[model samples]
Target: MRHDLRPGRLVAGLALILTAVVYFGDAGDAWQSPWWVAFPLVGGGLVVAGVVGVIARSARRRPESTPPADRNRAT
Candidate 1:
Protein backbone atom coordinates (compact mmCIF):
# COMPACT_ATOMS: atom_id res chain seq x y z
CA MET A 1 0.00 0.00 0.00
CA ARG A 2 1.02 3.55 -0.65
CA HIS A 3 1.92 5.62 2.39
CA ASP A 4 0.48 9.02 3.24
CA LEU A 5 2.74 11.95 2.38
CA ARG A 6 3.21 14.43 5.21
CA PRO A 7 6.06 16.97 5.33
CA GLY A 8 5.68 17.43 9.07
CA ARG A 9 6.38 13.80 9.84
CA LEU A 10 9.29 13.69 7.42
CA VAL A 11 10.77 16.88 8.78
CA ALA A 12 10.37 15.75 12.39
CA GLY A 13 11.96 12.37 11.77
CA LEU A 14 14.90 13.91 9.97
CA ALA A 15 15.36 16.58 12.60
CA LEU A 16 15.39 14.08 15.44
CA ILE A 17 17.85 11.85 13.67
CA LEU A 18 20.12 14.78 12.92
CA THR A 19 19.92 15.90 16.53
CA ALA A 20 20.90 12.49 17.82
CA VAL A 21 23.83 12.31 15.46
CA VAL A 22 25.13 15.74 16.41
CA TYR A 23 24.60 15.24 20.14
CA PHE A 24 26.44 11.93 20.11
CA GLY A 25 29.23 13.15 17.83
CA ASP A 26 29.97 16.01 20.23
CA ALA A 27 30.07 13.74 23.28
CA GLY A 28 33.88 13.87 23.46
CA ASP A 29 33.94 17.62 23.20
CA ALA A 30 33.70 19.96 26.24
CA TRP A 31 31.60 22.48 24.34
CA GLN A 32 28.15 23.25 25.76
CA SER A 33 25.18 25.00 24.26
CA PRO A 34 21.88 26.40 25.57
CA TRP A 35 20.16 26.99 22.22
CA TRP A 36 21.08 23.50 20.99
CA VAL A 37 18.38 21.94 23.19
CA ALA A 38 15.62 23.28 20.98
CA PHE A 39 16.18 20.64 18.28
CA PRO A 40 14.54 17.81 20.19
CA LEU A 41 11.69 20.02 21.38
CA VAL A 42 10.97 21.14 17.83
CA GLY A 43 11.10 17.54 16.61
CA GLY A 44 8.55 16.37 19.16
CA GLY A 45 6.25 19.26 18.43
CA LEU A 46 6.49 18.67 14.69
CA VAL A 47 5.49 15.03 15.13
CA VAL A 48 2.47 15.88 17.26
CA ALA A 49 1.36 18.68 14.99
CA GLY A 50 1.80 16.51 11.89
CA VAL A 51 -0.32 13.71 13.32
CA VAL A 52 -3.04 16.17 14.32
CA GLY A 53 -2.92 17.81 10.91
CA VAL A 54 -3.25 14.47 9.11
CA ILE A 55 -6.17 13.46 11.29
CA ALA A 56 -7.91 16.78 10.78
CA ARG A 57 -7.35 16.74 7.02
CA SER A 58 -8.72 13.24 6.67
CA ALA A 59 -11.72 13.99 8.88
CA ARG A 60 -12.66 16.99 6.77
CA ARG A 61 -12.82 14.98 3.54
CA ARG A 62 -15.87 12.97 2.42
CA PRO A 63 -15.78 9.19 2.23
CA GLU A 64 -14.89 7.80 -1.18
CA SER A 65 -17.06 4.66 -1.20
CA THR A 66 -19.75 4.51 -3.86
CA PRO A 67 -23.13 2.82 -3.84
CA PRO A 68 -23.44 -0.65 -5.37
CA ALA A 69 -25.07 -1.06 -8.78
CA ASP A 70 -27.95 -3.02 -7.25
CA ARG A 71 -28.92 -0.06 -5.08
CA ASN A 72 -31.96 1.92 -6.24
CA ARG A 73 -31.26 5.41 -7.48
CA ALA A 74 -34.85 6.74 -7.43
CA THR A 75 -36.58 7.35 -4.13
Candidate 2:
Protein backbone atom coordinates (compact mmCIF):
# COMPACT_ATOMS: atom_id res chain seq x y z
CA MET A 1 0.00 0.00 0.00
CA ARG A 2 1.15 3.50 -0.82
CA HIS A 3 2.01 5.71 2.16
CA ASP A 4 0.49 9.17 2.12
CA LEU A 5 1.13 11.24 5.27
CA ARG A 6 -1.52 13.88 5.55
CA PRO A 7 -1.27 16.61 8.23
CA GLY A 8 -4.09 15.10 10.22
CA ARG A 9 -2.50 11.65 10.06
CA LEU A 10 0.84 13.03 11.20
CA VAL A 11 -0.73 14.77 14.18
CA ALA A 12 -2.57 11.62 15.14
CA GLY A 13 0.60 9.57 14.93
CA LEU A 14 2.47 12.08 17.06
CA ALA A 15 -0.25 12.01 19.69
CA LEU A 16 -0.17 8.21 19.76
CA ILE A 17 3.58 8.06 20.11
CA LEU A 18 3.65 10.69 22.82
CA THR A 19 1.00 8.89 24.81
CA ALA A 20 2.73 5.55 24.39
CA VAL A 21 5.99 6.97 25.63
CA VAL A 22 4.30 8.53 28.63
CA TYR A 23 2.40 5.36 29.40
CA PHE A 24 5.54 3.21 29.25
CA GLY A 25 7.86 5.64 30.93
CA ASP A 26 8.23 6.31 34.66
CA ALA A 27 6.01 9.37 34.40
CA GLY A 28 3.00 7.20 33.69
CA ASP A 29 3.56 5.13 36.83
CA ALA A 30 3.94 8.29 38.92
CA TRP A 31 0.86 9.91 37.42
CA GLN A 32 -1.34 6.83 37.83
CA SER A 33 -0.94 3.66 39.83
CA PRO A 34 -1.93 1.68 36.75
CA TRP A 35 -0.36 2.27 33.36
CA TRP A 36 -2.77 0.10 31.41
CA VAL A 37 -5.69 2.50 31.75
CA ALA A 38 -3.90 5.54 30.37
CA PHE A 39 -2.14 3.52 27.69
CA PRO A 40 -5.33 2.07 26.21
CA LEU A 41 -7.27 5.30 26.45
CA VAL A 42 -4.64 7.41 24.72
CA GLY A 43 -3.86 4.74 22.14
CA GLY A 44 -7.54 4.23 21.33
CA GLY A 45 -8.10 7.95 21.00
CA LEU A 46 -5.19 8.24 18.57
CA VAL A 47 -6.47 5.35 16.51
CA VAL A 48 -9.93 6.92 16.32
CA ALA A 49 -8.47 10.27 15.26
CA GLY A 50 -6.37 8.61 12.58
CA VAL A 51 -9.37 6.76 11.22
CA VAL A 52 -11.40 9.97 11.18
CA GLY A 53 -8.63 11.73 9.27
CA VAL A 54 -8.47 8.98 6.67
CA ILE A 55 -12.24 9.05 6.21
CA ALA A 56 -12.22 12.85 5.93
CA ARG A 57 -9.50 12.74 3.29
CA SER A 58 -11.34 10.07 1.33
CA ALA A 59 -14.55 12.09 1.39
CA ARG A 60 -12.72 15.20 0.23
CA ARG A 61 -11.24 13.35 -2.72
CA ARG A 62 -14.46 11.76 -3.89
CA PRO A 63 -15.81 13.08 -7.21
CA GLU A 64 -19.13 14.90 -7.33
CA SER A 65 -22.10 13.00 -8.77
CA THR A 66 -23.61 14.14 -12.09
CA PRO A 67 -27.22 13.78 -13.29
CA PRO A 68 -28.00 11.49 -16.28
CA ALA A 69 -28.87 14.52 -18.45
CA ASP A 70 -25.56 16.22 -17.65
CA ARG A 71 -23.64 13.05 -18.48
CA ASN A 72 -25.29 12.91 -21.94
CA ARG A 73 -24.85 16.61 -22.72
CA ALA A 74 -21.94 17.65 -24.95
CA THR A 75 -19.13 19.76 -23.46
Candidate 3:
Protein backbone atom coordinates (compact mmCIF):
# COMPACT_ATOMS: atom_id res chain seq x y z
CA MET A 1 0.00 0.00 0.00
CA ARG A 2 1.07 3.60 -0.63
CA HIS A 3 0.75 6.56 1.70
CA ASP A 4 0.64 10.33 1.27
CA LEU A 5 3.65 12.39 2.33
CA ARG A 6 3.47 14.45 5.51
CA PRO A 7 6.07 17.19 5.81
CA GLY A 8 4.94 18.23 9.25
CA ARG A 9 5.56 14.80 10.73
CA LEU A 10 8.90 14.61 9.01
CA VAL A 11 10.05 17.92 10.47
CA ALA A 12 8.74 17.08 13.92
CA GLY A 13 10.49 13.71 13.91
CA LEU A 14 13.77 15.22 12.81
CA ALA A 15 13.56 17.90 15.46
CA LEU A 16 12.91 15.34 18.19
CA ILE A 17 15.83 13.26 17.02
CA LEU A 18 18.10 16.28 17.06
CA THR A 19 16.98 17.21 20.54
CA ALA A 20 17.65 13.71 21.80
CA VAL A 21 21.09 13.70 20.25
CA VAL A 22 21.99 16.98 21.90
CA TYR A 23 20.78 15.85 25.30
CA PHE A 24 22.58 12.55 24.93
CA GLY A 25 25.83 14.30 24.06
CA ASP A 26 25.50 16.58 27.05
CA ALA A 27 24.84 13.63 29.32
CA GLY A 28 27.95 11.91 28.02
CA ASP A 29 30.05 15.00 28.72
CA ALA A 30 30.76 15.46 25.03
CA TRP A 31 29.55 19.06 25.13
CA GLN A 32 27.72 21.60 27.25
CA SER A 33 24.25 22.95 26.50
CA PRO A 34 22.28 25.68 28.20
CA TRP A 35 19.46 24.36 30.38
CA TRP A 36 16.75 26.14 28.37
CA VAL A 37 17.99 25.37 24.86
CA ALA A 38 15.47 22.60 24.21
CA PHE A 39 12.58 24.98 24.73
CA PRO A 40 13.33 27.12 21.71
CA LEU A 41 14.46 24.20 19.64
CA VAL A 42 11.19 22.32 20.08
CA GLY A 43 9.11 25.48 19.87
CA GLY A 44 10.68 26.56 16.62
CA GLY A 45 10.34 23.08 15.22
CA LEU A 46 6.61 23.05 15.98
CA VAL A 47 6.11 26.47 14.41
CA VAL A 48 7.95 25.44 11.26
CA ALA A 49 6.04 22.18 11.09
CA GLY A 50 2.74 24.04 11.32
CA VAL A 51 3.70 26.36 8.51
CA VAL A 52 4.78 23.49 6.31
CA GLY A 53 1.54 21.66 6.98
CA VAL A 54 -0.47 24.69 5.96
CA ILE A 55 1.47 25.13 2.76
CA ALA A 56 1.20 21.48 1.84
CA ARG A 57 -2.53 21.49 2.48
CA SER A 58 -3.06 24.55 0.34
CA ALA A 59 -1.00 23.12 -2.50
CA ARG A 60 -2.95 19.89 -2.43
CA ARG A 61 -6.22 21.77 -2.44
CA ARG A 62 -5.38 23.70 -5.61
CA PRO A 63 -6.85 22.40 -8.86
CA GLU A 64 -4.43 20.92 -11.37
CA SER A 65 -4.17 22.71 -14.69
CA THR A 66 -4.87 20.84 -17.90
CA PRO A 67 -3.10 21.21 -21.20
CA PRO A 68 -4.94 23.03 -23.99
CA ALA A 69 -6.68 20.86 -26.61
CA ASP A 70 -4.97 20.60 -29.99
CA ARG A 71 -7.17 21.77 -32.87
CA ASN A 72 -4.83 20.75 -35.71
CA ARG A 73 -4.94 17.04 -35.15
CA ALA A 74 -6.01 14.90 -38.13
CA THR A 75 -9.47 13.31 -37.78
Candidate 4:
Protein backbone atom coordinates (compact mmCIF):
# COMPACT_ATOMS: atom_id res chain seq x y z
CA MET A 1 0.00 0.00 0.00
CA ARG A 2 1.11 3.50 -0.74
CA HIS A 3 0.77 6.34 1.70
CA ASP A 4 0.60 10.00 0.90
CA LEU A 5 0.82 12.84 3.38
CA ARG A 6 -0.41 16.38 2.93
CA PRO A 7 2.12 19.17 3.39
CA GLY A 8 0.36 20.37 6.48
CA ARG A 9 0.46 16.96 8.16
CA LEU A 10 4.13 16.59 7.40
CA VAL A 11 4.89 19.97 8.90
CA ALA A 12 2.76 19.32 11.95
CA GLY A 13 4.45 15.98 12.57
CA LEU A 14 7.87 17.60 12.38
CA ALA A 15 6.78 20.28 14.80
CA LEU A 16 5.48 17.65 17.20
CA ILE A 17 8.80 15.84 17.12
CA LEU A 18 10.63 19.09 17.74
CA THR A 19 8.39 19.82 20.68
CA ALA A 20 9.19 16.44 22.18
CA VAL A 21 12.90 17.07 21.84
CA VAL A 22 12.64 20.46 23.43
CA TYR A 23 10.54 19.16 26.29
CA PHE A 24 12.53 15.98 26.92
CA GLY A 25 16.08 16.96 26.05
CA ASP A 26 16.39 19.23 29.07
CA ALA A 27 19.28 21.11 27.55
CA GLY A 28 20.09 23.18 30.63
CA ASP A 29 18.74 25.43 33.35
CA ALA A 30 17.93 27.96 30.63
CA TRP A 31 15.65 25.45 28.94
CA GLN A 32 13.72 25.04 32.19
CA SER A 33 12.93 28.76 32.25
CA PRO A 34 9.42 29.87 31.33
CA TRP A 35 10.65 31.73 28.25
CA TRP A 36 11.88 28.44 26.75
CA VAL A 37 8.34 27.19 26.24
CA ALA A 38 7.76 29.84 23.62
CA PHE A 39 10.04 28.21 21.08
CA PRO A 40 8.18 24.90 20.68
CA LEU A 41 4.78 26.57 21.02
CA VAL A 42 5.54 29.00 18.23
CA GLY A 43 7.00 26.30 16.04
CA GLY A 44 4.00 24.05 16.50
CA GLY A 45 1.61 26.91 15.76
CA LEU A 46 3.45 27.69 12.54
CA VAL A 47 3.28 24.06 11.48
CA VAL A 48 -0.45 23.97 12.07
CA ALA A 49 -0.86 27.13 10.04
CA GLY A 50 1.15 25.57 7.25
CA VAL A 51 -1.19 22.59 7.23
CA VAL A 52 -4.19 24.90 6.92
CA GLY A 53 -2.55 26.71 4.04
CA VAL A 54 -1.87 23.46 2.22
CA ILE A 55 -5.46 22.33 2.61
CA ALA A 56 -6.77 25.69 1.41
CA ARG A 57 -4.49 25.69 -1.58
CA SER A 58 -5.50 22.18 -2.56
CA ALA A 59 -9.18 23.11 -2.28
CA ARG A 60 -8.71 26.17 -4.50
CA ARG A 61 -6.86 24.22 -7.16
CA ARG A 62 -9.70 21.80 -7.79
CA PRO A 63 -11.35 22.17 -11.20
CA GLU A 64 -14.65 23.99 -11.30
CA SER A 65 -17.36 22.21 -13.28
CA THR A 66 -20.41 23.80 -14.88
CA PRO A 67 -23.55 23.60 -12.79
CA PRO A 68 -25.95 20.83 -13.73
CA ALA A 69 -28.71 23.33 -14.65
CA ASP A 70 -26.37 25.22 -16.97
CA ARG A 71 -25.09 21.99 -18.52
CA ASN A 72 -28.59 20.86 -19.54
CA ARG A 73 -29.64 24.29 -20.83
CA ALA A 74 -28.65 25.56 -24.27
CA THR A 75 -25.73 27.95 -24.21
Best by TM-score: 3
Quote the lDDT for 40 in model 1: 59
Tell me the tens digit of each residue's lDDT in model 1 across 4-74. 56655666777677666566656747455455676656767677768866886787555567566435454
Residue 19 lDDT in candidate 1:
66
For candidate 2, what is the total of clashing residue pairs? 0
Candidates 2 and 3: which is better by TM-score?
3
TM for every model, in the order presented, reads: 0.41, 0.42, 0.79, 0.48
lDDT of each: 0.65, 0.68, 0.83, 0.65
In candidate 1, position 17 carries an lDDT of 72
Ranked by lDDT from best down, the candidates are 3, 2, 4, 1
What is the C-alpha lDDT profile of model 3 across 1-75, one tens digit per residue? 788899988998888888888899999999999879899889988889889988898987634563335333444
User: Which 10 residues in a row give candidate 1 its minimum summed lDDT?
Assistant: 66-75
Off by over 4 Å in 1: 28-75
Expressed as tens digits, the lDDT of each residue in 1-75 for candidate 2 is 776557666667777776766766656465554646666767777777778788879876635586677766764
Clashes of 3: 0
Residue pairs in collision within model 1: none
Q: What C-alpha root-mean-square deviation, in Å, does candidate 3 show against the real structure?
A: 8.2
